[model samples]
Target: MIDLALNFAFVAVGLAQVLALVRLVRGPHVGDRILALDTMVINAIGLIVLVGVKWGTQMYFESAMIFAMLGFVSTVALARFVLRGDIIE
Candidate 1:
């Protein structure tokens, strides 16, 4: 059923978010932590979309889009900082 599938997706994404958080905290390298943070952002977006589907609302979709854009920018900035020792030159 569609409802069952949605529930399963939610559970899977939730677990993924938790694991990503663990990796973010325990990762040995800065790059690994950054990757984990990116993964967490993706999982958060998945959760937002799932909530929008369940509630039949359009607002969550907009929120998800905004979050995605911000996540991307932040990730790029972090990567740049790690590589160049500064985000802005």
Candidate 2:
């Protein structure tokens, strides 16, 4: 069933997010931490989309888009920090 599939997808995404968080926490390097955080955000978006499909809501989808944009900005900021040792000059 579609509901069962959605549940499975949610569970999988949740597991991935947890692993990504752990990686972020345990990262020995700043770049590793940033990559893990980015992965977590991407997985979160997937989870949101799945939830939206299950609940039949358009708002969730829109929010997921916003989250994606925020994730991109965060990644850029983090990368700049890593490269320049400061987010802002």
Candidate 1: where is the Cα deviation over 4 Å?
none
CA RMSD, predictions in order: 0.7, 1.1
Per-residue lDDT tens digits of candidate 1, residues 1-89? 98999999999999999999999999999999999999999999999999988888898978999999999999999999999999889
Clashes within 3 Å, all models in order: 0, 0
The parts of candidate 2 lying over 4 Å away from their true place are none
Candidate 1 overall lDDT versus native: 0.95
- Which lDDT tens digits does candidate 2 get at residues 3-89? 888888988999999999999999989889999989999999998888788878898977899999999999999899879999989
- Candidate models: Cα lDDT each: 0.95, 0.91
Model 2 C-alpha lDDT versus the unseen true structure: 0.91
TM-score, each model? Answer: 0.96, 0.92
